[model samples]
Target: MNLELGKILFTAAIADAVSNSKDFSAFVCQSIEKHKTCNWGDCDPEDSHQNDLSFESGGRILSVYKNPAAHEDSEPKIWIITEWDRSITTVLYPSDY
Candidate 1:
């Protein structure tokens, strides 16, 4: 799949994880490879929609959703949102969402 990292808005806790550890990053990539959509059942109902899915990577959860605006002629752009274990969530985009 054509995956890319866009604007990564991280929460305070997630920011620390990104800067201090590589597990979170690895999990994101793995989740994309293993599951393309949010069929894992723990997804946030509010964010999930057609072509948009959520996943649980290790102890963290992430939302891998489609970016409607980033869609090309035939290809669609996907964005990753890093959701921390806490109540903190991060929004990211490869381009403007």
Candidate 2:
């Protein structure tokens, strides 16, 4: 994605990780509009919330493979083992991946 959308995604991730109230979470709703495939795994509907955790980041599809230990945890901690197609600008925010 473009720089603005990347920033918005970063902001939304921070919001998702921290916010407690519904009002606070609403900001991310608009921010992620550019990302057509914005998936939050357990946080969204359809009950296919577990197992595969994937989403769009910086215009590319991002997915995480869960280990047995990761699945056992309450909150799934993510680490970017590798990427598909990435832009140079996206590297600045390593924490996002």
**Candidate No. with top lDDT:** 1
Alpha-carbon local distance difference test for all models = 0.40, 0.30
Which 10 residues in a row give candidate 2 its minimum summed lDDT?
A: 85-94
Candidate 2 segments whose C-alpha is farther than 4 A from its true place: 1-19, 34-97
Listed per model in order, the count of residue pairs whose N, CA or C atoms clash below 3 Å is: 5, 2
lDDT by residue for model 1 (1-97), tens: 3223333454454345346546554544454543333342234566444224223322334455442333244223334443433234344333434
Candidate 2 lDDT tens digits, 4-43 = 2232223345445436545323433432332223332222
* Residue-level error in angstroms, candidate 2, position 82: 14
Tell me how candidate 1 scores on lDDT: 0.40
Q: What does the lDDT read for residue 66 in candidate 2?
A: 24
